[model samples]
Target chain A: MQAYANPTRFNALALTILPWCVGSTVLLFLVGLYYSLVVAPQDYQQGETVRIMFIHVPAAWMAMATYTVMALASAVAIIWRHPLADVAAKTAAPIGACFTFLALVTGSLWGKPMWGTWWVWDARLTSVFVLFLLYLGYIAIWQAIEEPAKAARLAAIVALVGFVNIPIIKYSVDWWNSLHQPASVFRMDGPAIHSSILIPLLIMALAYTMLFLTLHLIAMRTEIMRRRIHNMEQAEVQG
Target chain B: MSFTAPHIGFVLASYGLSALVLVGLTLAIVWQARSTMTRLKDLEGRAAKRRKPAKQVKPQ
Candidate 1:
């Protein structure tokens, strides 16, 4: 990890791995869409409406997963003072925010047909809303401050604090009486969803994950370039 | 697969929105990267010129 802390090594590795990541994302998305639209069995109750879950659920999963990644990266930046850790956390914010927004909008679109309402104050919905706000706030902190170091420190703290909501979002359906359904994929007894639906859902989730990786590497590389430009500017000013 | 379903509008909306957001983001990132790289290269070129011998400076 420390060896890759050097931006040159990180850039080389990211360049090498990014093609595979992008390729897998494209392949999975195509296959997943085919399965989702044509092959997966429609829900008995929800009928064709169940198809929204393919996009909605995966975006929600990525939303929460990206925040967890940001929080962990923030922790590394704080404790280990890893040089690139802050960069990882900072670059992840807009990407995570976009995913969170998609999850909310898509979920709302799914809800209108299923629950007879476009929005709700249920535990699951409310917690996810808070998670969205948290992403916005994190991004706001970065944009609001001119000093990058100060902004990074404050944003890391906000990320760590907001992480308390991640578990709540995951377990809201379980811990409270809510309109949202309980976990169907990751459970002690294994997936409750049928294999036909599960396959496409898993494929879509994999595609989302790959897309995140591909974007993250590009964002990180761009950030490194930005930092280099800043350094060069400072040197010119001094000289 | 058929758009003949009752709630097909919602499906179309969902896919359309996803494509729009993802494509917009990709374009924005690519634009930012290109612009910043150009700026950095221009700055480096200026700095290189400043370090060159005065006699070698091409009159502009």
Candidate 2:
């Protein structure tokens, strides 16, 4: 990990790994989609609406997972001043924001039929909403500041501070009465769901994880290139 | 998979929107990568050209 603190080494490593990530993402998505749409059985109670679970659950998971990645990267940036750490954190925000948005929208779509309403200000929903705002706020800090170092520092602080919400989002359903369902997949007793449903759900989750990885690497490479361009421009002006 | 099934719209809409958003995000990142790489290479080429010494003119 420390080896990648050098931007050049990180860029070379990212280039080497990118093709594999893209290939795995595509293969996983194909297999996961097959399992989700065709192989997975419908729920007896929710019927067709349960189909939404494949996308909704994975999106929610990625939303949290990406934010966690961002927070960790931010911590690395602050503690060690790892050069690529801020790049990782900064590149992750928009992707995380997109996942958060997808989760909310898909959850809303799932909710209307299941809960007989479009939305509820329930603990789970509200906490996730706050997370979406945190992503936006962190991204805003980066954009609002002109200096890269200043922006990175401020953004890292925001990410670390906002991370308090992650646990709240995870436990919201259990901590309070939520229209959202409680932990079924990531529980101590192991997934409460049957194999038929759980298999495809897990596959979809893997697919989403690979997708995040692929996107994150690509975004990080772009950021490194962008910074290089910035440095060259400054050099040109000085010279 | 049945179109006539109840609440099917909700399920289809969820998948449709998810596909749209995820694909859009992927495309945007890929496009940015391509553009940034191009710009960086262009700048590097320009810098290299600038650093090259001017050719000596032949004496009249």
DockQ of each: 0.53, 0.85
Put down candidate 1 lDDT per residue, A85-187, tens digits, no spaces: 9999998888888888888898887877776778766555676788899999999999999998998899999999999766766576445644555433221
Local accuracy of candidate 2 as per-residue lDDT tens digits, B3-53:
788999898899999999999999999999999999998999988887665
> Which residue pairs in candidate 1 have backbone atoms (N, alpha carbon, C) closer than 3 angstroms, thus clashing?
none
Task: Please give the lDDT score for candidate 2.
Answer: 0.87
Q: Which sections of candidate 1 miss by over 4 Å?
A: A166-192, B54-60
Candidate 2: segments with Cα more than 4 A from true spot: A166-191, B54-60
lDDT of 2 by residue, A1-239 (tens): 77877888988998899899999999999999999888887777778777788898888889989999999999999999989999999999999999999989998888888767777766667778889999999999998999999999999999998997667665765466545554332211123688888888899999999999999999999999999999999999998
Q: Each candidate: what lDDT?
A: 0.83, 0.87
